[model samples]
Target chain A: METAISGAILAIVTTQKDKVASGVPVFFAKDQEEVQRTCILLSRVLKAMTHDLENGVYILVRH
Target chain B: MDKTIQIIILGIIVGTAARIYMLRTDYRQYPSYPHGIVVHVSLGVLAAALASLAIPALMEKEYTAITFLSLAAQQFREIRNMERETLSKLEELSLVPRGLDYIEGIAKVFEARNYLVMFTSLVTTSVALWLGLLAGIIAGITTILISMYLMRGRFVRDIATVKPGKLHFENSLLMVDDIVIMNVGLEDQREKILKDGIGVVVHPKNDNGRAILNNLGQRQAILHDVSILVGNKLEVGEPDLTPLMRKDVDTGKLALFVVPNEKDLECVIEAIYRTPILESAAYYPLKSTIGKSAAD
Candidate 1:
């Protein structure tokens, strides 16, 4: 009976803002360092995994 | 004392002894420490008492005593439920949870052990009542040995061969040999993985072994076992370091990627080999005619 959301993108951290435009919250990082920091913080706070799209976009998803 | 009393006492002693002999706090660390052992041993005593009294009761023309056997069966079933509940509840707090399949297997073993105790008591008591004390002692020892033999289930090495695998990164993706484990987003994490991560490949000997490796629960069991022995780098919210098993699509071979604290490849390989083949994950496709032909 217990259920929780999984495999859903909770947030997006991207170096290129124009590349990721979705319903989820998006964090635009000015540089590679900021992008990595943002994604790691988001993943820890959200208790999710950070997966790289390998196209300037990193996604946080609970799985 | 009466001859029946002598027989009943012998049965209880042998049965309890057998139960105690079977109970051991191994690497699994199951049944907890002192309290868990106390609970199971007390239940074993009760099961033994019930079984040992049966023959004597039957000899006394107590027909109603037969119903107690049925009641004992119900009680043992409750023990299985209790074990499953306790383990499932604790699974939430475990760093590497033993999956449902492994839990069920353990629960079933707990239940079966009680039955084995009962059987040992019954046989020993009956033999004593019919033959003599010396014969009964011999029979009790024999049954205990037999129970020990029966309880020794197959390990992973019996079905598959485990060997070290090469860990490398293909851009953002982590690969154990050719099998893709997962993608790490952070540069720091990927570098840590490349340096600390140990990979092991499991090759199934036959179609049956391949089918078992395909089961997610079985894969989880391998990860859990290896992590326990080698120590896992995973922490809360740190899924990047979690041990994972991924299989090649074309072949049934599995590759495990684990960021262990020890970084010992030998221990990891040994742990994987020692993992018990879960009963739920075992598939006998080779036993069927259709599957036999399809395997080719």
Candidate 2:
């Protein structure tokens, strides 16, 4: 049985960029509303699922 | 007509009838009309021809023709591979692909149906040659009925109970009753899910049922079938409405969440109940002594 991660975080959209590390592409938003818009746009562009980290950070993952 | 010719034609007709009876272009929309039907019927005729020839060849002391049955078996095996390949290739582009377990079950069914056709013809021809045409027709009808009964596999309803579950959001986490499905990052998406989503809980009746539900492939099959039947809101670049199933760690109950085109809770529950229990995912651990002892 081969085991590997089925999904990967393609992009991160966050209001607090200080909390997120920089490996994958990251988008910074000014507020909660901006964060939602940016997350939706990034998810659409990346064609990935937007998952809430629930701490002002959203990660786009392709599953 | 000559007796052998009569027998061959009778077997071919009976076997093809059996195949046609088993072939359903139902909600699954499989063995797609016209072309797929034509392919399968042609194969059924070929299998019936091979099987119907067997008894007559033996009656005439022509033993060499018996080897051809093995050749036909090889042909049927190739058909299984052909089906698997076709379905697997088609799966790549599907929004909700039927998992490998479901595909294997379908392919196996295709192969087995061919064998059932052969058996029906063989029995029909043998009984007709030994007894009479009337006896042969009776035997053919009986064999077809038996084959149909035997081919019917257990569905999810046999092992589990399905009921509508409450869909709610605990912050960003989507919950179907007590089970947490996944996190929705977008506020609008969460609102859409709240407005349109349907939640269902599948409670297994026994340890065997629990084990089968535990299979990821089986869970996926349930999702795929439910999506196909009820129609899902899932689309390209929109994973927000993607249907998901999550299990309770404490209990074996599965919680399914789907944003269906039609938000009829009862229809979704019915779709869940009707999903065929995949053959590969079937588990009978309770049949073992150790498992039985541990269950208590």
Candidate 3:
């Protein structure tokens, strides 16, 4: 009986479960180029590590 | 006493009943009703039935007007179902409230268009059918063939667009607050939807993250909109937000290598592994359900 009253519209709005923000600032870097360079270097290192891990070889061996 | 009169009246009654049944069923399955298609279809069938009765008499042949309207109504049902599937998906993504719908009584937008298109095709075919039995059969066959194409082909987008005051998902409409968002784009359509359905903490529009979508060459467009969730593995320390790796050299000094973006799609998977859920029960973006090539 009460189901119709709390359909999709009600459900999305009435999130009884609140999402607590960890307040872990997703953004930290103030400089743009530094952030980009950081992200790029991090990405490259991750890529090489992953390749070594998948191929069962060390980066030095691959090099 | 006249055959045309009898046929026309019979068509009206039968077609109307079928439509009512179809609409009732749609209401049962979908969260919202397909108002536009139902209204257009119901009226269209009634009009066609009356027209078929008169037009055939004037032209001196049997018309499939009633049958066509009835069939078209069924197809409208299919269209509404597809529309609802999209809604259910968005609903899952949006995490609607528990007790009151922020969106209620809003009908799907394209239903009417879809219904009218089918009805018009039906009427066109019925006219052809009325020309003769052969004409009717040929028209009916052709219509059926086309409906099959429309049913399977990715001919239209089912995504919602932003309106002045409301959001218009393909068939279903919604009130502003029916979905989740971390931000709301003001004064424009670009990056508007990114802020809705589900949004991550870091705006993909990070002053530094440059993303571009190349439509295989016809055009290139910026696509900073990430379907990332709040707590998903995000590389915190940068150059690339990738996890760190270190090596020991001959002098026992520590060295490190960073991940690259292109190869980082691999890192993306790793990042995916490292990423935690944004919220305890947060919903993921549903836009991923649709196939990509279909959009192209």
In DockQ terms, which candidate is top? Answer: 1
Q: For residues B1-296, could you state the per-residue lDDT of candidate 1 as single tens digits?
A: 88888889999999999889889878888875799999999999998899999988998999899789899999999999999999999998887889999999999999999999999999999999999877887898899998889888888898899889999999899999889999888888899999999998999999999998899999989888988888999997888998999999899999999999988999999999999999999998999999899999
Sum up the clashes in candidate 2.
0
lDDT of 2 at B153: 88
How do the predictions measure up, each by TM-score?
Answer: 0.97, 0.97, 0.26
Better of 1 and 3 by DockQ: 1
- Pick out the ten consecutive residues of candidate 2 chain B with the lowest summed lDDT: B24-33
Off by over 4 Å in 1: A1-4
Using TM-score as the yardstick, the better of models 2 and 3 is 2
The candidate 1 chain B region of ten consecutive residues with least summed lDDT is: B24-33
Candidate 2: list runs displaced more than 4 Å. A1-6
Cα misplacement distance, residue B115 of candidate 1 (Å): 0.4
TM-score of chain B of 1: 0.98
Docking class of 1: medium
- What number of backbone clashes does candidate 3 have, counting pairs of residues 3 or more apart or in separate chains? 35
